[model samples]
Target: MKEYYPPPTPHEHDIEKMSNRITNARIEELEKLKERKDELKEKIKEKKDKMKEIRDAMERGDTADMILSSSAAALNKRGKETSNLTNEDLLEIQEMAIERLEEQFSKVEEELKQLKDMESS
Candidate 1:
């Protein structure tokens, strides 16, 4: 004897359609979240690079121009003569700016962590 399978009832069909819609909506949300996570990671990397560039420029002394360009206002505000600053002094000032950048980077890192947690859930 042959076995026969019955077609789905209307309620069953509706439930399947609703399930697909929920699944698609979830996939879209994850995609958007992944994109935002990628963006935050890039920003954190750029901030790190900027910190390294400042340190490298400070070490060489030759690229004083690069360091000076960013820290000139701070030096001027302190009523100090920019031309007279020792390499060590410039490094110290740059360290302060780096500290500020690090604080901002930490906040971004926390946001990225939150995104990761959300993605996992």
Candidate 2:
């Protein structure tokens, strides 16, 4: 085995190596998260299609970018209240639909939670 020694002062390369390792790890986690989000979006699409098909089978119908602007308009402190919402929020988000909305809401909420955790860490 080869023994490694630190220089009198560890060089930029060592610091860079550590930073690079952390960055690579974060990127890998982000990639996995993106992949998961994609999968969930696909599943959501499939469910929405199924909902449409159900409606179509019943009534014969078929069918749909978005941004918020202005920093001046803001409200509420963001601790647990804003960024982290509750089960009631989940319920309200799904209040309009039958079972499908609830299912999708749960999935979406879970995904949001995971992303939030990643961001926090």
Candidate 3:
């Protein structure tokens, strides 16, 4: 004879539904975090590329004598010589800024790892 089983109680069904919702929410959160991490990586790469361009320009001595009007080149003096700041000094400042961006990228990487661990558990 087959064994008889009772259907799940109302409370058990509610609990199961809630658990599924929580799992879905966690998955969504993880996806968003991963996306953010990717964006940060891209930003860092772009910054590095820009830094290289700045270095090349500095070496040519062209960028030092004039400033580009674009917001990105806003720091340039537009042919007005800064008494105290050299191209080398400006390059150093750019390096410092890149270092800060790298720090932020590292933090995002760490956060993504933590979220992955949580998802796995």
Best by lDDT: 3
Model 3 misplaced stretches (Cα beyond 4 Å): 65-86
Prediction 2 TM-score vs. true: 0.42
Candidate 2, overall lDDT? 0.52
| Comparison by TM-score, 1 against 3, better one | 3
In model 3, what is the error at residue 39, expressed in angstroms? Answer: 0.5
| Poorest 10 consecutive residues by lDDT, candidate 2 | 63-72
lDDT of each: 0.67, 0.52, 0.72
User: For model 3, how many clashes?
Assistant: 0
Q: For candidate 2, give the lDDT of residue 69.
A: 10
**Residue 24 displacement (Å), model 2:** 0.3
1 or 2, which is superior by TM-score? 1
Once superposed on the true structure, which residue ranges of model 2 sit more than 4 Å away at CA? 1-8, 11-13, 60-121
Worst 10 residues of 1 by lDDT: 61-70
Q: Write the per-residue lDDT of candidate 3 for residues 1-121, one digit (tens) a residue.
A: 9999899999999999999999898788878878877887787788777668777777777554342325335434365434455567666766887788778878877887887798788
| Cα-based TM-score, every candidate | 0.50, 0.42, 0.73
